[model samples]
Target: GKEQKQLASELARKGVTKEQAMRVKQLYEQQNNVNASNATGTDVNESRLREEMKENTSDMLEDHPSTQDLARSNQVFGRNIFNTRNLTFEPSVNIATPLYYRLGPGDEVIIDIWAASQNTIRQQISPDGTINIQKIGPVNLNGLTISEANDYLKKTLNKIYNGLNNTNDPTSAIRLTLGSIRPIQINVMGEVVQPGTYSLSSFSTVFHALYRAGGVSDIGSLRNVQLVRNGKNIATIDVYQFIMKGNIQDDIRLQEGDVVIVPAYDILVKVDGKVKRPMRFEMKKDESLSTLISYAGGFDADAYTRSLRVVRQNGQEYEVNTVKDLDYSVYKMRNGDVVTAEAILNRFINKLEIRGAVYRPGIYQLNGKLNTVRELVNEAQGLTGDAFLNRAVLYRQREDLTTEVIPVDIKAIMDGTSQNIILVKNDILYIPSIHDLEDRGDVVIHGEVAKPDSYPYADNMTLEDLIIQAGGLREAAS
Candidate 1:
């Protein structure tokens, strides 16, 4: 207590009031003796607490992110819906919306003076943004807007006129009108029918740009339009909504240096397996399974239309049985869908050989379909000029190697009585042909393929997968 008095006195000597010094000393003593902080029986050891915190943080990093935590993130803030309406600096086109601006250096301006030519004049704001009038001498307009500049000029001109013509009162006020850029210029590019910079009489919106760009290429999609400003992506406009839904708000006005990019339409579904034509067909909005089947020249007789599988980009699939459809001709298709049709040849469930002459041919998807008997014949080059129609049969077997051969009469099936055996998963077909003894072995494919192929098969393996495995198929060759 005596020490406290001395400390208080010392504090007082440092210009602290006697009351303040005493209060601080008393408070310090009480806190030290009584332990003002939260007193805890379970004292946390710093090192142990730190280690536990580290482990907890590591565990949090490992566990899949919880939806609750994800929702609070900024990304989710705009996920459901958010806007930058509060933003002040939204660059806009020259004139779709009348924008007001004060004058700046390099900003052109036109002024109208009713006075005679000998009295009034046309003048440009100087580099310093100031203009000098004949009678008004040097009127400082630097950093002032056109309206402000006019006010300054009018006041000065009125003063001079009132001095020159004492009878004419210097009471006329000034007015300023900011004019629009008569010919606004903008650039359009990428997947457009007519891509170029267009000069607009007034600042126009994205629609005018597309019109100036020759209204987009046939393959261009207006739905996902990109509006770039100052070499940066400013907006992702839904032009489709702007046109079809009549949502004018979606059509934002464009500014100079704003590049409008209309992305190319994604209109393709990969038709593989058992089709007469295996290619990417440009899709239509009203397209269905029949459209794709017809695009692939309809189904082959042996096509396992029942096991029609649609593989999407992420490996997720929607498999349908065209055979189960009863009609077997209509299934709606989506972009990037991989339609897998069943093969006609008999498969050995898990064991099969692709003994055929095809480019990079081999045994593929166990039950992956190879089209009509004719397609198989073509894969093996139609029995190598030595095959007999009577000897032709699609051989099948159980996993135990129990074998059964079904003679396939190509002509009879073509005439339409054949069930045209549908293909199944893991079913391998054997297209056998007499091989020249000097051939030593069957055709082989390797090095960069998902499944290195040795036998010549037509289906199962895809060109993309093959290229991915072959170190991306020497680009120079492509």
Candidate 2:
């Protein structure tokens, strides 16, 4: 009852209709009653009731004004990379420390001094970015590269030990190296799946921080990811460049207290039909239709490259415009634009087909040399001996897309008595065989015959011939 009241209150807050609210109340009551009655019933009954209730609730929620908008903004391209658990962007601790890596707090520094007497010292950088050496005193190494820190350390330790900086003095040598790396805190906010602060390794890049924050949200823009430092946007990282071309030039290493912001998309266009990859893609303002097509993996083999159809939303309504191939580079795409690459028409040009009573009947080219009906017949190795020469039908498609049967006098054309009929595109010529023109019945010799089977009838055949062909009559003949 308490849950029902809360649901009703939420529905009222959302301005849902009174009838809809009452329906939800009825469904809740039905669920409670079902659960109470099914206490002693099988698990299947309870599971079925739960499923039905869930489906009803989902249906009602789908009809809600707020959920309808969410349903429309479902999937976007390049957004599912982080949704999988199999892939991770965690920085490996086993990698060698980069030379350009700067020293910071929480990082361990190792100093090895060897001479007639060797000694090793290991110290972690304090919160104030200083590591204390036993005899050499405290040395600050903040915001300095590894090389710079090594030089500073060598100069500071030289005062305590003699000949520490002399390269020729192998007996008195010093080495400095990093031990354990530090961890940096990064804030990933704005249109991300999980917008919060993430504690990550200092060696982590922009991708690592995004992975820790559960990647960009559905409405987030992957094309313009900003890397903000000290309240200033330092770098703009385009994830599409990395996802498409595997170029991670802009994936800079993170610093302490860095911010990775994934703002909402600026322009989103969908490319559908006859493309290698058909889906919605986020584009930048300066990008053109050609760039969008490249993101969709170019056009499929059967795509009509001559032109494309684009539907753009103008005010409250949508207007369609046909984009030619020449204008693909210049055409600017707008938000909510849908571009379609339709397949070429399923019709062939400069082709003709011939079948029925032909020696080698098949498709033939309708070129200048083979334009007439006589030439097409000759290209098909001429017609068979049983071909009916009186009339042949040519199925031709007209401009209206309707089939028109044109009768060709094959006998007149072959005899050169009539003018040769010129063939057009997609014309199917059919010359009927003589047998197809007439029905030849079969003769059945049953009962008294030795072979009681049907035989094809022939002209000028007598009863004696029929009996002989049937292996003579049986001895018990009627």
Per-residue alpha-carbon lDDT of candidate 1 for residues 28-83, written as tens digits (9 for 90 to 100): 55545444363752244434444554454345345534444333321211111111
lDDT of 1 at 387: 32
What tens-digit string does per-residue lDDT give for candidate 2 at 223-336?
Answer: 899999999999999988888999989889999999999999999998887888777899999899999999989999999999999999999899999999999999998999
Per-model tally of clashing residue pairs: 19, 0
Highest lDDT model number: 2
> Which residue pairs come into collision in candidate 2?
none
> Which residues of candidate 2, in runs, are more than 4 Å off?
1-74, 112-119, 160-164, 167-175, 409-419, 442-478
TM-scores for candidates 1 onward, in order: 0.30, 0.74
C-alpha local distance difference test of each model: 0.54, 0.85
